[model samples]
Target: MTDTRRGSIQRLDNIAVVVDDFEAAKAFFGELGLELEGEATVAGDSVDRLIGLTGVRSDIAMMRTPDGHARLELTKYHSPSPLAGDPQAPPNVLGAHRVMFAVKDIDDIVERLRPHGAELLGEVVQHENSYRLCYLRGPAGILVALAEQLG
Candidate 1:
């Protein structure tokens, strides 16, 4: 880690996802309106080399949201391994995680994604904090959330 000055952190840059097929993952996310930013390889000695006795030299894809701030990075390990999927339980399960996006028209967005093959996980609920939210499983079991904060 670099020893930088105080208040060095300005903002969030990106999020990453490891995918088996780069083109397919990009296509899936592209349908949701995120644009492809670029692609690259994790080339360096300092990175991990062995995963369950398999070598690790992988290619990756980087994508960005429409606003051009947050990012989605997809990486695929060349070696075979157990497939990745949603945790065998609800979001309350330990270590379970999902990405949340604040949207203006949650209902409209939900409707729009139906034709693109998104599965509605649950009905939108009004929370105690004046928030309306819902869960949807998008391409490749990706858990996406839409939230409208009334607070």
Candidate 2:
């Protein structure tokens, strides 16, 4: 049998995070070092149908790392409202709960993000011959892991 494959996958465009405060979420990611790429409002039946929500309207902010290869989309739904979740949910709870980023200096980054209300979920720990990693609870209780490579 011959191998049959459709269009090849290009690259990951962005990760979407639904938040209650669009501007605050944008600022959180920005303080964490992601540059604001752009922001816009999305509506219409097509969007609603696509997201499986009726009368859905949202404001979205696109954030990108300095390298420009990675992106994060922060969205705030204005119609049909949004729901609240356990912000402090444990890691084992499942679903897409966290995003990890490689950083040059985890400690420094953590310090800088403190004023923005970024709290370390636990102490930063060094993994044997791999990395120094720590989980941070950022705006809206978004969990972000920071990894600094070891020499």
Candidate 3:
């Protein structure tokens, strides 16, 4: 069979999250095990035009997952400052809810992230015999979930 979605779209480059505390957000994801691929400050007319904003100046940290299949881009705006939103917005709120990662040890990951200000939204629970999962709020109130496969 032919692939219906072959050329319709390519891979997802990354998911960008804007934040207030740039360093903290970077550290949070770093502690979660994402490697720092690179960092740069973006500006200029091209950037403003692309994002539909004026005088845009933002610093970005590109984080890569250990498996190299995914990336999370954390952005901190310097000029034309970022707007404030509900940092503690519940999962029921609209828009992109949470970003999930497949972890090897759910409990250990959760415990390690605690000092970095990770707050569990609920206790980790097993789903049948397939996996264990939990949701937690990280820096800038970004919701993240972890799942560990079971044998």
Candidate 4:
């Protein structure tokens, strides 16, 4: 009898986020301390077909954490344009609402991002001795949560 087991799945490649402004989104995530990995512009029918959009042209920027375990793909659509949505939508509204990160100093990171217009969704709070966390609203209404682990 032949074996019918499937191959093991690989690690996550990256998380993609659609944004309105390319440079602003890059700067926002950069301020949060994620290193910029690379960037490129993609277009033509091949890209459109791959993304299931018509005549899609976009600029993509990839950012990875210093540890290099996680990554984010930021895309700014130029052709066909991006549609507007509720920027103030709550976390429970559904869809991909936020991305969380483990940081060494959450407070300091938050302070640094404040000048770039990042607003805390709520005050930073500690959950017993597990973690200290807070969510910040970044450019294009992207929500980012930072958690500092307690020793």
Candidate 5:
């Protein structure tokens, strides 16, 4: 592990994505090789106040990568209905753009995700001899990127 510097952040715990279908989102990430960590319903005064919302109740599915280095949290709001946003917005749009994952076979992973409504934002392209990459819009129109390293 790298030495921690004073005033420096330690590490990223997880990335959260709000979805409309809890099951579908779980399955989508499952197909991409993320193992289910657990499921839970979060609510109560603390959660509501933390998110700046009242009466917040949501179902969450936590999935971690096979290496256990990355985690993705999928949420489905039950109370104080989730706000609307442009999930289908192009990559150029602002805000949290996309989440990228490294893969062994980009084609195989792409084929598997297609059955779960994964739509390619652009054709898989090779970058020099370093990696092959592509971006796809997954459930909830979330943009996901896949990279396959090449030797």
Candidate 6:
């Protein structure tokens, strides 16, 4: 092996998730603890340069973390077909997955989401590392995960 050293890695920057309704997804994530940072529009030119798209109108919502380091970017395209099959299923076939957030009160957060039409995909289970997590589907099948860090 080469005797070379690299600089230390820093904290996570951000992750992006595609949504059906920008406003609804923003509200859903806000209820889970993240705060809406702002929104942006990506014109067709930008989209084409990014992914060979002729035109694209997307609404982007930037959610800030409490610590102000990592962020969750939610993007909703104005024109796109709905996801097929069971939307609740993991997007393994499509190469996408849900983002899991660690929280202090997972149960309480899940309770708060009940009234807003959020549904749990599985029962919350306690793990060995003093953790508990539950899968949830938000508005428009937006996959979400709520986890409590007891350790």
- Candidate lDDT values, in order: 0.72, 0.88, 0.91, 0.89, 0.94, 0.77
Best by lDDT: 5
Question: How high is the lDDT of residue 134 in model 6?
Answer: 88
Candidate 4 clash pair list: none
Model 4 spans with C-alpha error above 4 angstroms:
1-8
List, residue by residue over 64-150, the lDDT tens digit for candidate 6.
978787799998777443345456666454765777888888888899888766898878998897789888887767677877888
User: What is candidate 1's lDDT per residue for 1-151, written digit by digit as tens?
Assistant: 8758886877777776666557766776776667888887764444454333344467877878888888888777664453676633466766666777777778888887887667778899989978999998765566788898885
Question: Please, what is the TM-score per model?
Answer: 0.70, 0.93, 0.94, 0.93, 0.94, 0.81
- Once fitted onto the true fold, the runs of candidate 1 whose alpha carbons sit more than 4 angstroms away are 1-8, 43-46, 49-54, 80-88, 127-131, 149-151
Candidate 2, run of 10 with poorest lDDT: 1-10
lDDT of 4: 0.89
For each of the candidates, give the backbone clash count: 3, 0, 0, 0, 0, 0
For candidate 3, write residues 1-151 as lDDT tens digits.
Answer: 5569757656688999987888888888998899999999999999999999999999999999999999999999999978888888999987956889998988889989998889999889999999999999998889999999999
In candidate 2, clashing pairs total 0
lDDT of 3: 0.91
User: What is the Cα-based TM-score of model 4?
Assistant: 0.93
Alpha carbon lDDT at 94, candidate 2: 67
Residue-level lDDT for 73 in candidate 1: 80
In the predicted model 5, the residue pairs found to clash are none
Clashing pairs in 6: none
**Pick by lDDT: 3 or 6, better one:** 3
Instruction: List ranges where model 5 is wrong by over 4 Å.
Output: 1-7
Candidate 3 structure, TM-score to reference: 0.94
Winner of 1 and 4 under lDDT: 4
